[model samples]
Target: MTLGALMLVEYLRKDMVAHGKIGLTMALYSTWNRGSSYPRDKVIGLLGIIEPRNSFKPEYSWTVEKVYRVAMRAAIAEDGNLNCLGLISEKKQSRNKNLASWVPDFELHSEPFRDYITSLSKVLNKWSIYKAFMIPGGSPDITTDEDDSVLILKGFCLDSVSVVGTQAPGPDFESVGETDPELWRSSTRDALNQWRSLLPPNDIYLTGETQAMAFWRTVLVDLNQGRLASKKGGRPKRLDKSDLQDLLQLETTDGMEGLLSTWESCLRPIYRQLRLIEQFNRRFFRTESGYMGLGPPDIQPGDAICLLLGGSVAYALRKSAHETWTYVGECYVHGIMDGEAAVKAVEDKSDFTEYRLV
Candidate 1:
């Protein structure tokens, strides 16, 4: 391995130690093969062993081995960023509250415990059902409002497309608890087969891997500590089929071709929006809210601009009837928005739409 690759592998090894063997390295690059150009952010992201502030060091001062050593130490330390322990500690100390209890059973916002579980369940269900999608990557981003209410945002879309059909099937389990061992084995295989068949023939899906699990755990710890009511039985709530329906954006198809076309149309806008959001988050680096990266508006707050790629979307897969994250992976085949070349990308992809920040 090159110095950079060695540094990265060591960094990931440290994270695995810190995060209790959970797969937290999806934030690292999986796109390239052995000798391709490295993605710098992913390497830095994996180096969560170092403080984000101290991640990149002066090239002249530190040798490759020294940097790797330092990163590994950071990953295993008490305050390491590689895992949720520190975050859990912070959650325990915080005085904020959870708003999940206020969410209603009939409403998507109601029954906060069930709500979160339901969303998670759908992801699990998708993983079980879809054979073509790769496992989910990175982590889910969870936040809260000023009112102490929680907002759980999980990012999944076209990114999980590659491993579909290629993954060796995992061992199956029957129900969470099964009395008959033989029946359980058979049921497990049946379940796996059912999952493989339910997915669309050629579409992409999410896998909700280890990093996503860690993210969910942290968010749950935060929620439990916050103002939300604890469950009566002290057990994590389970979401059933009906509850699952409320969280997904499954389309009622008029037909297959139309459905595909509509989904394709809706993708560009969502991709643009997510790119802007990621850029804004990186630039500001805030724990909470602020106007996106464009700076405060001269007329109002910050002058906000929306860059529309490929004109207006031909159609949107999930309509904006409610506040929901619309994920469109694989849209940016060439580049992302964080680099120095971002301006060029915008110019090449679409016209930048300047708008008033509301």
Candidate 2:
């Protein structure tokens, strides 16, 4: 069995010992890789392990798409949070076009990297780091149509994408054994330079941090300073003054290329963290209001950055029809991640608009 499978087994064992019943959402996420010859088995096979309180039953006649859709809706309703939405793949990575944009494709294992910083598999653990909806007393307000095809949510649009940069190199580019190490470094440096240029000329973001600081933080999803902030009981914090000084040094140096050549010890950790993010398929984008972010690889120029009621992170959404939106994947917008946008909307008395996701 793979390491992930083993970890899942261990987690289930621990859960049985502590809680006596596995959580429906945690069970689904952990067993996502347990595929079978029949696609329906993906959801049905999980029945033996999950809690008896769950309403899922073997529906052999249902199509694979329907099974996944039902499973996703049930998981969200039971969890009372939008964490399951984080598992939805980017548009290009998804295999089932028929499945609703909000539903996760169980067959496609797009995320291979499981480092502490980027992996979303452990739902409870990652929530501490990506708290986009930090406001207290918030809960998911989810409903579905008669056929359960449309997912209705309540949230406000945060911003619209205006500029999108090139996608960072894939995992192949960073494989030292298969490709030249120098080529990998050179390509990454070039990508970083392009992303840096895409930032607006403004020195400071609305969050009051320097452009350089925000750029670095966003690329690493604000987890670069070390794993302490993301520990079990810890909360994500801003990059300190010392971190800013290192970034400023890189800024003054003759571009990223020059700084890479120097190979300074202080800068190595930051670059290492950045490389971790680049290995994942994602793109850097700036919103119309100048907010910077890193999102799914398929994110586009006009996609909407929205903060769903109970989501722990911001999401990228595409308007597919006059009255509905398509879920583009989760994203990391710099300025409004920690509930700043929600606070402002509340102060302004902005109404929570209904988003119908197809």
Q: Quick one: best TM-score, which candidate? A: 2
| Cα lDDT of model 1 by residue, 130-243, tens digit | 111111343222232432232232221111111111111111212222234344334433432332343333232222223222222221221221111223212223333453
Q: Rate the local accuracy (lDDT) of all candidates.
A: 0.23, 0.68
lDDT string, candidate 2, 1-358, tens digits:
6444555566566667766778666676665534477777767777887756544664888888888888888877766777777666434643687889888777664233322123332253324455666446556678888777898988899999999988765434222223344755677677778998998777888688888888877875765333344343334345666656666555664645554443222123223322223225578999988899988888999999998887778888899877999888888888776788888888999999899999
RMSD of 2: 4.8
Worst 10 residues of 2 by lDDT: 113-122
Off by over 4 Å in 2: 1-10, 13-19, 90-94, 110-126, 134-138, 173-183, 225-242, 252-279
Model 1 scores what on Cα lDDT?
0.23
- What are the RMSDs of all candidates, in order? 21.6, 4.8
